[model samples]
Each structure stands twice: as C-alpha cells, then as structure tokens.
Target chain A: MVDRIPILKMGKYLLLSIQVDMHDQLALDLQEDLTEQIVRHRAKGVLIDISSLEIVDSFIGRMLSHIANVSRILDAKVIVVGMQPAVAITLVELGLSLEGIATALNIEKGMRWLENSVNEDEIAGEPESDEDTDAPSETGN
Target chain B: MTKTQTLPLKQETDIVIIRQRVRKAAEEARLGLVSQTKIVTAASEIARNALIYGGGGQCLIELANRDGRAAVRLVIADQGPGIADIERALVDGYTSGSGLGLGLSGSRRLVDEFDLKSQPGAGTTVELWKWK
Candidate 1:
C-alpha cells in the first residue's frame, strides 16, 4: 500500500497532506504521524488537508479527536480543511467536533487560523482554547 | 488446514475490507458481487457493534460450507464487557455508544441468517452468513 500522507514544513507550521481512500484506520496512522510532527518540530501550528477522503466513519472521527487532543498538548494548534459536504453532514450528525477542532475553507484558511491562534497564544500565555468551540449549535441547521 | 483470518474491529469501515476480500475470494470461487455486498453488510454491522459496545473486538471472517451454497461466514467477536441485556440490545434505537447505533439491529436486517450471543463481563459474538 502506498502512503499518500506527507508532512511539509512551511515556516513554523507543518502542512500535513493526506489523500485517503476509504478513510478508516488510515486516519489513525495520520493522527499518530501528526502528533509526532507536532512534538518533533515544537511547531506552532498544523494544517491537515484531507480533501481526498471519500468516507468518514467512526474511526476517522475518533482519530480527528485524538489528533486535536495531542496537538494541544504539544502547544500547536490544528486546523482541519477540505472536508466534503457529505463528511461534514455526517460529522454533524455524529457530533464529533463537540470539541472545538477548527475547520477552515481550505488549507490556506486552516493555516491562517493556526497562525493566529499561535500568535495569540504566545501573547496571552496559552489560555485554554476551550473545547466545543467548533461544535454545531443546537439550532439544528 | 486453510489459513484462518482475523479482522481488526467489527466496523462499517472494516466492512469495506471484508467485502472486498470476500468478493475477491468469492470470485476466485466464482461468487458474484451483489450477494457478497448484502451478506457482508449484515455481518459487518454485527461485527462493528461488537467493537463499539463490547469494549472493542475483532471480526473473524472465514469461509464455511464451501460445498452447499458456497457461503462465507463472518464471526464478529469482542473481548470487551458484553452487552448487559441481550434482548434490549437487539431492540432498535437502544444505543449506548456513539453513532446511530444502527449496527447491531441493522446487521440483523442485512444477512440471510444472523446469530447473536453476548454474556455480560465476557464478550459478544455475532455470526452472519452470506450465500452465493
């Protein structure tokens, strides 16, 4: 199996590119890899681009949570980008992002979110970002 | 003896792998895709349930009754604490874990024949059959 995941260094942030087919356990590996990169680089932010994923299931959902959790511990903010509408709908239904994992329009937006978060954190001494920031409100839209 | 296979978790995602491998093996044995998908869905759902509620378990997919109808049997077993109440678990919408909880009951809806066994503090085993 070819590994379609890569970690690219752009300034202090790592743009982790993942093109996943049938995203199941593959997400787990990606989570682990991203966590390692966060620690190794002592980097400030992450941009995980998963636009190529076809299906997002429970495992992938869990992996995203895991990645966000670990990245926080490493003092690096994470921004998830390029989610398909189907995946977004399913995630809302499943309520995975009840813990605030940022989602931007694309990799650029994610990177900017992380960069801003990192800059803000450095100034304010890393206030708790608070979970559920990304959660869908009860409006049920 | 034919090599026995072990699956990671009884999950919808794993179902994709199960169907693909089962179909490949079935085609090697001359089985078609339509029947394979139906049966695998039923069996995979049961297996997936075992993973989530049973404290996580694996799916044991194997070939059985290569003679009669060339059927493949998948035994999704979990080592986690078993379901507290069997009958309630079978009831639709009785979800304890995450997602839709459509796996256990939905799996029952998919396969030709479904056999479910669970013992609290022990684990769970769901046997599903797909016939060609």
Candidate 2:
C-alpha cells in the first residue's frame, strides 16, 4: 500500500528511505526493494539509515542479515546506520548481529565512510558485480 | 500534530497504506533516511500486533512531546484478551503461541519507548515512541 517507497540515489549508491506504520509488511517491502536496487544499479555498497524508525522485529533483523548476504554476492557492502538505542537493544536481545557489515554514526557519516573507502582503496577488493544476488548459483544466494 | 488521538482498528493490509502515509509525512518533513527507517521499523511491528493479537485494532501515529522535545508516538490498540502475563511474554524465547514470539518482546527492543497493557479477554494496548 505504500504507493512507492522513495529511492534516494547517492552517486552510484542508493539510499532507501522507508517510514512504515506497520512492522510486518514494511519489513517485507524493504527487503524486496533493497534486493532489486542492489542488482539494478550494481551499487558498490549500501547504507540503510534507521534513525527515524521506531521499531524493528526479529524478522527485519533476519532480513537485514540476509541483505548483507546477497549484497556480498552482488559485490556490494552494506552498512546499517542511525539505529535508535531501543532498536539496537531489541536486535541485541534477539542476538542479531550485522556480522561483517559496518554501521556508521549517521547517514552522513556512512556516506563519508564509503566515499573515503572508495577514494583511498581505489575501489580495491571490488565485489564481483552480479545483477542477481538471490539467484542460486553453484554456491548459494 | 500535538493533539493526542486514538485511531480506529483496522487490518494488516491497512498497514501498507499507513506505511506509505507515514513515509510521505517523513519525507515532506525532511526527516532524512535514518529517521525514516526507524519510524518504519517500529510502526510495522506494533501495527501487526494489533491486527494479529488485538483481533484487529486502530493505529495511532502522532507528533507528540517527550520531555518537551519533538517525538513520534505510535500506538496500536486492540480490545482482545489483554496480556495475562507481561513479564513472561517479555522473556526472550518465551512464546505462548506458535510464532517466534518476538512480535512483542523483540519489538520492545526495537523502539525507543515500549508500553504494553493486557487484561485477559478484555483487550490489549501497546504504545511505542521514537524521536529524531
């Protein structure tokens, strides 16, 4: 029902901003859009800013973890930033960890970090660009 | 925006429209992405609880004040069996139903403010708040 979830483009990267009133469907939609964007743009990395968000359930935390997995497949790194203290605690209780994913102070900091990483490394360790991260390869999604 | 209001109960499908409306409000207000995500996450969980547990309820999203600062107050209320045991339900891995049981307790961890009220078959009401 969210007519359209806004897609904010930051250079080759995309900023997916979502404000959902319900917790379940919102998580589903976000997961869908993020996966599509990762492939559509072949983005180098993704930053999911959750500052204004009010709640995050186990499903979302799991979805985010899944996003990181697929992102790695698409050759992109994902950083979840601006997590509210409460959301942080919930994820902790659920024992949800971002693993190798990075989190920044805020969206601005996230962008700055990515920019610097790209500039300094000359895009070193570029993740092999694959349009579909969900597709089952000889490996996995 | 400062008014304290209670919304009418609706269904899970209604959440999609609510999500879009909230997202639009956030964008127009220039809350940025971080704010948007946080809002969406909390809203979705609370709304779903109302539909699933409350036997259908209303969603209330208001611009309220917490200690005199701008804040987002979200509430999903249902007149279903109120939570009989709040403490037990809060414990991680404690589930009375077949679901993961993270819906209430897990969501409690997801938002800045979480409040729940349940009294047997009477009903249940939950309140969650997140600020800039």
Candidate 3:
C-alpha cells in the first residue's frame, strides 16, 4: 500500500508535514486530498512542514505551487515552512522561488504567520477581493 | 579512481530507485549536505526527463576523483524523439511538457559541471558532475 502523508487539523488551519521522499503520484494524491480536506474542514490556512524533505525537485516544486494555487482558489492561504537552507538554495538555483506562496522558518513561525494572515483577512472586511488581489498574476486568466 | 552503477529508467518506480542510488553515491563521495541535495535534485530532473521525454533509457552514477578533487557524476541518456533545439530546451521556463520548464536549466545550476548532447530522431544524453 502506498503511504499517505498525514494531514492534521488544528483549529482553522490544516497541517501537513512531509517526512518522506515523495514520488510523483504521491504528490498528486496529497494535492487532491489536501484540497478536499480544506473544503471539508473549511480551513482558513494551511501549513506544510517540509523539514524532513531532503530534496524538492521540479515535480514536487510544481506540486507545492499547485497546492498553493488551489488553496487560494478555495479561500485558504498556504504557508510552506521548515524548508532546509540547502533545499532553498537548490530551488533558487533551479529558478524556482516558489513565488506567490508564503513561507516561514519553522512550524512555530508558520503558525504565527497563519494567525496573522487570518487576522488580516478578518480585518480586511472584503476577503474575496483582498484574496483576489494577492493571486499570482501569471496564474490569473 | 572511478566506480559506476547503471540503472534502467523504464517507469516511475525507476525514478525513485535512481534518486536512492544517487544519494548513496553522493554519500560515498562524501559530499556535504547542500551538495548532496543539489546533485540528487539534478539527478531526479534528468532521470525524469529520460523516462518522460526520452521514452525511457538508462542512468549511470559514478564516483570519480579529478585533479585530486573528488566528485560524483551522473549520465542520463534516452533513445526517444530527441530534442530539436538543445539551447531552447535548456532555457528556464521553456518546457515541451506540462512542467514549469525548470528541470534542464535548474539542474544545470545545481551542479559544478554540466553538458548536454542530442541528435534529432536519435537520442539525448545529459552529463552532470558535482565536486565534493
């Protein structure tokens, strides 16, 4: 049986910590499952902890972007936390800044970032327009 | 000195195996954390290219010492339709597939040395080297 990355629900946020080297199919599955979980739980933010991930290839990179984009469409913000310095350098070298996605140094910081974003969204009043304003321009049709 | 191991790139599972083998080889070469991550990431990109774009081929991982410096080398070759423009293919954000077009250019940036050779209707071969 293919192992599934566990997604935990904490308050209004969903937490996913990737501890394994993800294959392409698994990445796709996570994308599908995470989006579904977001809708079911009506999560306001997602914190993906990748501290254990040794490498982030283009496929996984794209998957992360896809997840962020999809989550945005569903009215959720995504914060990718715990990315290794090495991985970050490699991604930059690979020409992937993981643009338009929020990031933090660790899970603690990630949680704080999510809290701030949720609060900011609440204060913004018109959540729909504010989120639309932050959508990655290239992905907007 | 040089030691080499070859793996077939026939399916998705093969890509996983390739990454594991590359990680082991990098360890044997005593590459640091970032270097190891870079080489492994590069290897994954090219191996996937071999399977998806090249229609499956083979990968060779080698540990070598040049000019008294140690390094790991990867050679992923495919016998597929072949690329018409090697230059264009290496450009960032230039993909013939659904990918973000960062594989070739990004992999190139990850290693210490890189080379690519392709002939239309024949095959494509990518050589990557990372110094320890």
Choose the strongest candidate by TM-score. Answer: 3
* Rank order (by lDDT, best first): 3, 2, 1
How well does candidate 3 match the true structure in TM-score terms? 0.91
Chain B TM-score against the true chain B, candidate 3: 0.96
Q: Write the per-residue lDDT of candidate 1 for residues B4-112, one digit (tens) a residue.
A: 4776764546656654565555454344544554454454455456655675677666666645876677777888788788788777656787655555665565556
lDDT of 2 by residue, A1-141 (tens): 454567676777878655644345566677778889877886777888777766565566667777878887766677788878756754565445656768887889998887776555455643344345555436754
Ranking, TM-score, top scorer first = 3, 1, 2
Off by over 4 Å in 2: A9-12, A19-26, A54-63, A84-101, A115-141, B1-6, B13-47, B58-88, B95-100, B106-132
Cα TM-score per model = 0.55, 0.54, 0.91
Residue pair clashes in candidate 1 = A100-A132, A100-A134, B10-B47, B10-B48
Instruction: Report the Cα lDDT for candidate 1.
Output: 0.65
- For the second chain, the TM-scores of the candidates in order are 0.78, 0.80, 0.96
Query: lDDT, candidate 2, residue A31?
Result: 74
Q: Write the per-residue lDDT of candidate 1 for residues A35-95, one digit (tens) a residue.
A: 7877777778888787866444445556777787788877778888998765565444333
C-alpha RMSD (angstroms) for model 1 = 8.9
Task: Kindly state the fnat score of candidate 3.
Answer: 0.82
User: DockQ of all candidates, in order?
Assistant: 0.10, 0.23, 0.75
